[model samples]
Target: MNTINTHYRLSHQIQDEAFILSQAAKCNLYLSISQKSIRLAVMDTERNKFVVLEDYELITVFTPMQVAEQLRLIAQENPLLQEQKWNTIRLAISNIHFTLVPETLYDPAHQHDYLRLHSDLNPLQDVVLAYRHNSLEAINIFSLDASTYQALEALFPERQLQFVHQTSTLIRSVLHLAPRTNLRSMYVFVERNYVTLLVVGPSGLEFCNIFHYLSPEDFIYYIIFVMQEQKMNPEQETIMVWGDITHDSSLFNILQKYIRQIKLGKKPSDLEYSYKFHDMFEHRYFELYSLHLCE
Candidate 1:
């Protein structure tokens, strides 16, 4: 049997942190961090082997001593093999911010507060939580203009406050995925009832238009008009869709008649086949389309 050694590096320390760093032997690790948990993986350098070793949760009362003890136990249980050597445990701390709902009063029903906080574009909104990712810690807050801050303050006059700017790598990744110009157009029809227009290319994906309650003719016209605006020929392009629309008679027939080529998106195997509820239409369509294109 062959043995491999891996090291773990931690930074952005906070009271509550979630992150993962894997592939340590060759000095590269896959890092994933969020407010609620952290995950890390260690990969074998010689054989392209890897395993996740850290997936831990942090709490408000957690202390450095407690964390050190936890790491010690992990090292003992997963003792380094002879051929594989582990050394120089690296750690850092950082803070992460999560949105809080005053109305919910820390109840389970408000569990989605963190997701909503990250999604809100309003700067005045404030959240409480100093999540440590690695070795750095700071209070997470919303940076808002004076007017927005005043408006939000009025809404929750007596609530405790902490503010931190949004600066998570995950957030940055999402921003990078925003649409760039390469492909002319992308369209998603959901179960024949709704339509979403996406502008896609090398840059990424962007939402152009979302249409519901429109007739199939009008929707087609709208898409064609958009293509013209973007200086592209509609006849040369393709439209993609996903969802359960097996029973929609009129919409299905219209799609067959007017669209040059329609495709359904499939989930990428690399993505673990997990679908976001809000992204079901776009992801499914894109996945299916990608599968067919690759073939």
Candidate 2:
């Protein structure tokens, strides 16, 4: 069951028959939070399979308080989210104000300083956080609205929450899924109005950035521009795509017009999914699923 209100709209809800509310303590809860949307995913740790998934498309939520209020409304409706305790609670924040810094250069004391270079973060309004990438030997520094962060804290007051940047989760999952070779490969995560372009190399992530587009032309332009900057041949190098796009989408059609090889990415191979998810697009909710890979 789902509902659509003035503040937010429920877009997808999938659950396995085996999911039991009484056994929620044995499951892990993951949430992907942003101003545009909030997604909830539940994984049964004992079986290592995802049992529940929900996506809410937020509307006109531009301020921190607005986003926080929307989250409260969602929690009120989602029974799964109403559960306070779980095996683990992971929340990923999505925003453009994030910068990747090498682990060697990262200083926890100056995390805010690092992010300041990329965005104008207000000390009173924004909270700076960092997620370390152990495998990639890098750190992702990002900002979250202080009020929104506090709202999450208040909601799960007793539960220990693990916060991570959306890009960090994407990077972690892509590395594990990308082939280990010297050849550079590009992986794209497409969302409502933005696309995250990542180029993974043999050793680690070569390039990663988010681009906002107003049109299909802007979307393909960024993709092609990044490929050119990386010196990847569009004819030879293949791009694997995931997220809220379809094969018939104008974004995909334009992508096909320029790039010779484009492949739709599959769900993480190491993880299992419930049969309820079989009918859904495998590429969608990738970052939400990748939360399992986040530390």
Best by TM-score: 2
Segments in model 1 whose C-alpha atoms lie over 4 Å from true places: 1-182, 191-193, 273-295
Query: How would you encode candidate 1's per-residue C-alpha lDDT over 48-133 as one tens digit per residue?
Result: 33322334443331433333333443344532211122212211112222432333234444444544555443334333333222
Worst 10 residues of 2 by lDDT: 1-10
TM-score for each predicted model, relative to the true structure: 0.32, 0.96
lDDT of 2: 0.90
Model 2's TM-score against the true structure? 0.96
RMSD after CA superposition, every candidate: 17.4, 2.7
What lDDT score belongs to each candidate, Candidate 1 first? 0.37, 0.90
Tens-place lDDT per residue, model 2, 50-74, is 9999999988877777888888887
> Residue 186 error for model 1, in Å?
1.5
Model 1 TM-score, all chains together: 0.32
Clashes of each: 48, 0
Candidate 2 ranges beyond 4 A from true positions = 1-5
